[model samples]
Target chain A: MGDISKKDRIITAALKLFSENGYHKTTVSQIANQAEVAKGTVYWYFDSKKELFQAIILTGIQRLASKIENRIKEEDDIIEKIKLIVMIYLEFFDKGRQYFRMFQEGMLAVIDDNFKNKLMDFRTKQAEFIAKIIEQGKKEEKIRLDVDSKDMAYLLLTMLTSFNSHLHYDNDFNIISKKDTIINIFLQGISR
Target chain B: MGDISKKDRIITAALKLFSENGYHKTTVSQIANQAEVAKGTVYWYFDSKKELFQAIILTGIQRLASKIENRIKEEDDIIEKIKLIVMIYLEFFDKGRQYFRMFQEGMLAVIDDNFKNKLMDFRTKQAEFIAKIIEQGKKEEKIRLDVDSKDMAYLLLTMLTSFNSHLHYDNDFNIISKKDTIINIFLQGISR
Candidate 1:
């Protein structure tokens, strides 16, 4: 994890800067200073700010995907797998709220559009991977046969992406703040 | 439609400048020059750049929300209304993509957290309004009764926020990109 350690350090600094100053406003020098690494070291890990941010975006998404992948791999049943996916998703997000913050708010929006396109492509594959798993569940007849794998995959992703991960806000709505209850309502419906 | 005309012109100019030059880089004078409106006229319509951005965010959300509201308003069926909301949301995003593109990226991260706080509050109210509508649908027994109103509201809002109007991304093939398709997948689920 030597390279990973250095990469992670850079990412941590990048996150703070991005959140505090916006992605574009933050500079390589700032990240280098924060990382306590020399400018060349920063470039050694990431050649440019855009490339560094690309690393961050990919790292964030892949980290979540890896965690989910492992959790799903442990479960054999399709129903159990999906439920686990949802649960683990909220659980991991709860823990990695900063990553979620950056990911959701477009920390890399200042990066080139081509890079954004690549991130979306990465996301697409991740969704397809989930859809395929759901498809397997469908074949087992474990999930609803009529269910659309692709749509479910997309909905799950967008929903997951939308979760702000912060518990408190300017408002006082204790009713809408809990995660377990929120997940329950999502899987089912609120009406009678 | 003079007001509409003026508003449209301002929005158009703002969209291009904000997207390309960013919030700070793009100034009111720049906007006025581009819109071809007198600097005083720009100031008359908007007090300052901050107000202009607030206007941009508010107007964008209002435009999208109004479209969704109109589409779902006629439907008494909660499920149908939900579907329509999804559909109209996708279409609205398609129309306002440029506006969203402008504010959606690195700029929001740079803006004062207070501004975002207000915007997030606005989003909550918007979601609550939809939730109330769904709640009514539940009472009328036209919608499912299992999902929590708050969670459902959050779910819909998240989808809209994260999905860029729920329009299909080329990367996401698991779900239908169109409005009606997502609504169907959402209401019925993939389960046969």
Candidate 2:
């Protein structure tokens, strides 16, 4: 029980430090101090600083994917699934804003080939997941038949991501309203 | 004439290097070498590497703003103006892909107070520009009167930026079709 809690604490500490100082500027000792764990204890869970960074990123993506997938599995209505997905997305990023910032930085950085491959796979999976939802909508006749599910999926993902990004840049933005507005805009064009 | 040409070359080289290696990894001497100018010449035109970076970003923004504004002025029809604006935006970024990549990096990086203020001002100007178009549409009764012009402007801007970003990540994306599709989706939406 203690081992599990110690590992979780180390991860939480590393995430905050990495976000504040960036991957290159942050160090293991700082993470240890922040976590209030012995330096050697970090090594027990992760091999090195690089591995820990990778773990933080990989874990974030995987956790988000699984959470969305599990919740979506319990839903049958296409529109409801989309609304739920958007809510989950906004909530996840809202809670882990720092982690998302780090993720964006990691994307631009020239990382190792293994990490690059993993990132690519994650993006593909995300797009595919959205596409599946659009496909389901089409089957239910909830979406326009002429619409390409893949294109619409991409567009929806873009809308959600961009709206979330704006929230980070502008603090005064009303989150709940923004989420609803995004969904409304997606469903109905700004037409009379 | 020679001095002006040298300055142009220096800016061009610096833009490419900075895009490839990021701001910190790049150096003034490397920029000079790439530009085929002496190190002193780079210092002559720009006080520091930081200034050069600001110049690259500011130039890109100003040029885009001017181009969109001028073309918008040429058209009285709101729909036509929107189409032309989208075309020009895609063309500008497609031509200067490297510069766009660098701009995104700069936004994420920690910068000086002056630069941050300028960035904020630039964003306001951009949103205002878009809002102006939407307001015109509303007056022309081409758009829904109930829609908040400011929110719609932000949404349109988000769609354009996100679509352009996806182009960078996915090389197989068809640019012209994507542009048309984004405009279509914005105007009509994907609902049946």
Candidate 3:
């Protein structure tokens, strides 16, 4: 805490508080207190709680995308890369369950247009990241050429989100088996 | 409105307001006004706004389940039944977009334990409905026997939800083609 800047400390404190208490319940004063700063200092960094939340979401998206990119940088097999991406997503969300809650809140709540657009941009960026991988697979002759990469990317991301929700809500879900199930179903249809 | 009972009128009014202005913004007075009922009448039928919202959600789940059951009653092919189930879900949510929004709200918001349990029940009921169809498919030797019906059912439902969100948010999505894509991807692997 001492080494890091006040802004980073504020973000760290806010993330913990937000995840624990939720968006509406959390207050800037609490965040400032948790970050060991004054309320005025907190406002100096962020205009409002909503803007602070937006920053967290947007930063989270970028961090996740880069983490996925970094993890799969060396994997040559496209199928394995896809599987890695799924696993990383599951693990990432499992750890940062707050982001998932915030995402649902952002999507469903009557938020302003600017925040909504940021969310949209997050989705598009994520899809594009996966779509690029699918395109690479096509180039490598590993993936079928008939399917639309962009559409497939979106569907895959959606499935991952669904699995994430299950992981959070359903206590009986076995993550290891479920990971295999997702990869298998994605690569091979369920049809006999 | 005249044909329905007072309870039904209140439910209808509540759903519309909840969907239009969201759950927190809507008030009992507004609901009574919309339903053309006295405020006491609304209170007589429902103890509180939260209870009214819960009733709406529970009724919606039952209605959707029965609708899917009726639509696929005559479809003999298990695979075709599954397809019809997907189509019906898309159509149902498309028409009653409010339900989808409410679902998101219910899942993410820090609501009461009973409401959360009801939501879990709604999800389980939906999955079980599809799992029954998959079981039938397995008995008919149409779907692979190795895959767990319940898990597959959950996955299929998740995919449908992903598509529903897309339908509501993404203006560029082509429903006709997207339906075929989901069916195709589910029925056949993306791999050639």
lDDT of 3 by residue, A82-125 (tens): 88998898788778776666555444443677876766777788
- Please state the interface RMSD for every predicted structure, separated by commas: 5.3, 3.3, 3.4
The window of 10 residues in a row where model 1 chain A has the poorest summed lDDT is: A166-175
lDDT (10s digit) by residue, model 1, range B8-81: 67767877888565565677788888888887877777767777777777777776667666666678766666
Computed on alpha carbons, the lDDT of every model, listed in order, comes to 0.64, 0.74, 0.75
Ranking the candidates on TM-score from highest down gives: 3, 2, 1
Give each model a TM-score: 0.77, 0.86, 0.87
For B24-133, candidate 3 gives per-residue lDDT tens digits of 56788999999999999998998888788878877887888888888888898887888898788777777777676665554444367777677678778888988998
Name the better of 1 and 3 by TM-score.
3
lDDT of 2 by residue, B1-192 (tens): 446599999999998998886665677889999999999999999997878899888888888889888888888788888778778887886777666666555555545678777766876788888888878787777777766778777666655654555445555555666677667766664222
Clashes per model (N, Cα, C within 3 A):
17, 0, 0
lDDT by residue (tens digit), candidate 2, A127-173? 88988888877778777777677876766665565455544445455
- Of 2 and 3, the candidate ranking higher by DockQ: 3
Number of the candidate with higher TM-score, 1 or 2: 2
Alpha carbon deviation, residue A32, candidate 1 (Å): 2.7
Q: In candidate 3 chain B, what residue range of length 10 has the lowest lDDT sum?
A: B162-171
List TM-scores of chain B, every candidate: 0.72, 0.86, 0.84
